[model samples]
Target: MITVNAPYAVAVHEGNDFTANPPHTSIWGLLYAQVKQADGLDYRNILLNESEMKLKPKRKQDEIFSTFMQEAEERRAEDIRLNVRHPHKVDATAIMQDVMQQMTIEKHNDQSAFCVWSNKEVQEILELYGLPVDSSLSILCVEVFGQVNNTYEHIDDFAINKSSLIKNTEKEFGSEVALEYNRTIDVVGPQPPKRPIDPLNSHLGMHRILRTSPLTEVPFVCCTD
Candidate 1:
C-alpha cells in the first residue's frame, strides 16, 4: 500500500478518465501534483502552465496540449545538449586498453580470439580497473564491436570480435593505439566463403557472423575462435 500526502493525491489514486464529460478534475489535480514534484524550475513551469490550461475553456485545451508538448520537447532537447557537452567521466582509453589486454590474454590461453564478457563480469572489470561502474559503459563497448542478442539467456553476454574491436578502437582511441593494438593482436582477416551463402538455408553448413562497416557500407565476416 502507498500513501500520498498532497490534496490532489486522490486524483492519482482514482485514475483520470479523459473520455468523460467536463474533463475530470483528475488531470488538473494531477498536473498540479506533477508541478510540485518536478525537479527543475523549467519543467515545473511547463507543468504549472498545463495545470492552469486545464481550468480554461474546453476548445482551448487542444491548443494548450500542443503548446505544452512543444515546450516539453524543447526542454528535452536542451537537456540532451547539456548532457552531450558534460558527459560522465569515463576513461575510454584505459577501458579500451584493459579490454584489449584481456581479450589478448584469453585468446593466448584458450586459442579463442573472441571474448564474451557477461554484464556481471564487465561490472567487476570496471570496479577492478578503478573505472566508473556504469552499466551503459558495458553496452557502449559491446555495441562498438558486437551485436547483442534479443533473447533473455544470451542478452547479458557481450561477444566482441577482434576486427570490429580494432576498427572501433581506431575511431575512438586514435590511430597510434589502434595500430599498436592491431599489431599486438596480429590481425588476420577471415577467409571468404567458397559458395554463395543463403541466410535462410541453415543446413548449407556456412555459419558466419556478419558485421557491416558504417563508413564503407560493406558487409564482412567476424571470425570467432
Candidate 2:
C-alpha cells in the first residue's frame, strides 16, 4: 500500500482525468460512494462536521453577530420614532387646565408668581406621553397662551405667564371654566400685587422719546426698534 499526503491525495482524487473515457467517474466520487455504501455514512457530512469544528475559532472572531445586533438596535430605534405621538396632537388645553388646577393649590411668593409652567416641566410632560421633547413644545405653549413676551418668557428658563394662561383658558374653554377658575383663585386668596411699571423702563417709551425729541433729527424710528 502507498501512503499519500493529505494535499496530494486531494489533488489526485479531485483533478480532471484526461485519459479516462467519456463516462469517467472521479476517484473522490468513487471513494465517497464506497464509504456511504459500507457504513451508511456520507463523506460530505463527515468533512462538513470537521470543517465546522475547525472554523469555530474563526466564527468567534467574526463581526457578523455584532453587525446583526447593531442592525437590530437601529430597527428598534426606527420603530420607536414611527410609533411616537405627534406633538400637535398633544392635549395642550387639558395640560394647561391641569397646570391651572395645580397652581390654585400651590403658592408662588417670588417674581415667578406669574409663571404657570416652566420649559423643563413641559418637556417632562411631553416625555411622559412618549412624544419628542423640543423647542416646538415651547411654541405650542405660546400658541395655547395666545401671545409671546406677555404670556411666555425665555430668560435663563422658559416660563408661561399666569395672567396670559387665565385669559387663554377663558378664550379656549368658554365662560364656565373661567368662572370656576376665578372662584378657585378667590379661595386661594389674592396673589401678591405686581410691582408698579415705569413707562420709561420700556423700549417703546425710549423709542417715543427718540422720535419726538426736539434734539433728534431722525423723524422715523424703524418699526423693528
Candidate 3:
C-alpha cells in the first residue's frame, strides 16, 4: 500500500478473478505498504481520465460497483462449486455478515472495512521491493483489482483459455453448437489501444498492484533485552 510517494508516479496494477473475496488483504495491502516505505507517492485515486476524484460523491457509486463485484464473486463461486468439490472454504457471505454484526456501534454506523495481514506477507513484499527482510514500517496505500469477468465479446464465459475453452466446450457443448455462436477469439496483431492515454480505464480501481510501506516501526520496542 504505497501512499502518494512518487515524483512522476508509477502505476501499481493489482487484479484477480472474482473468487478472492471477501477481498484478500494481501494483494492491495502489500503494494501500498511497500510503496509507502519508498517515500513520496502521491495519487488522486477517484479522479483522472477527465473524472473527478471526488470521494464523497463516489462513495455511493463505489457501493454500487462493489455490489456488482460481490455478486460476480458469488456467482463465480457457485459456478466453481458446480464443477469441482468445494474445499470447505470459509463462507464469505456468512463471514461478512457476521463481521458486520460484530462491528462496534460507532463502526457499524460509519461502515468501515477491516484489513488483516500476517508476518509472511510483509516479508514477501519486502523481497519484491529488493529490501532485506526486517519487518518494521507503516504508512502505505492499498489498491485492489477483482477480475470477476471479462468484456471480450467472442470468448465464452466458461471457456477462458482459448484452446482449452474451444476444445472442451466443443466436446461437451458440441462444436456445431459452439460454432453457431461464432465464439472464436480473433488474435490479431496488437491493435493500438482504443484510447492511448487511459486504455482500459487504467486509472480506475485495480490497475496497479499496490506499492506500499512496511507495516511496522523502524526502531523496535522489544521490552526484555
Winner by TM-score: 3
Which candidate order results from sorting by lDDT in descending order? 3, 1, 2
* Residue 209 displacement in candidate 3 (angstroms): 12
Residue-level lDDT tens digits of model 3 in 14-63: 64223221232222222222233334565221111121111111134345
lDDT of each: 0.34, 0.30, 0.39
What value does the lDDT take at residue 156 in candidate 2? Answer: 17
In candidate 1, which residue ranges exceed 4 Å CA deviation?
1-160, 187-225
**Poorly placed runs, candidate 3 (over 4 Å):** 1-137, 141-143, 147-160, 180-183, 187-215, 218-225
**Per-residue error (Å), model 1, residue 193:** 24
- Best prediction by lDDT: 3
Q: What lDDT tens digits, residue by residue, belong to model 2 across residues 176-221?
A: 8988876764564434343333222232232222111111111222
User: Which scores higher on TM-score, 2 or 3?
Assistant: 3
TM agreement with the true structure for every prediction: 0.14, 0.15, 0.25
Sort by TM-score, top down from the best: 3, 2, 1
lDDT of 1: 0.34
Each model's RMSD to truth, in Å? Answer: 30.1, 41.9, 18.0
Q: Positional deviation of 57 in candidate 3, in angstroms?
A: 39
Query: Candidate 3 has what TM-score?
Result: 0.25
Better of 1 and 2 by lDDT: 1
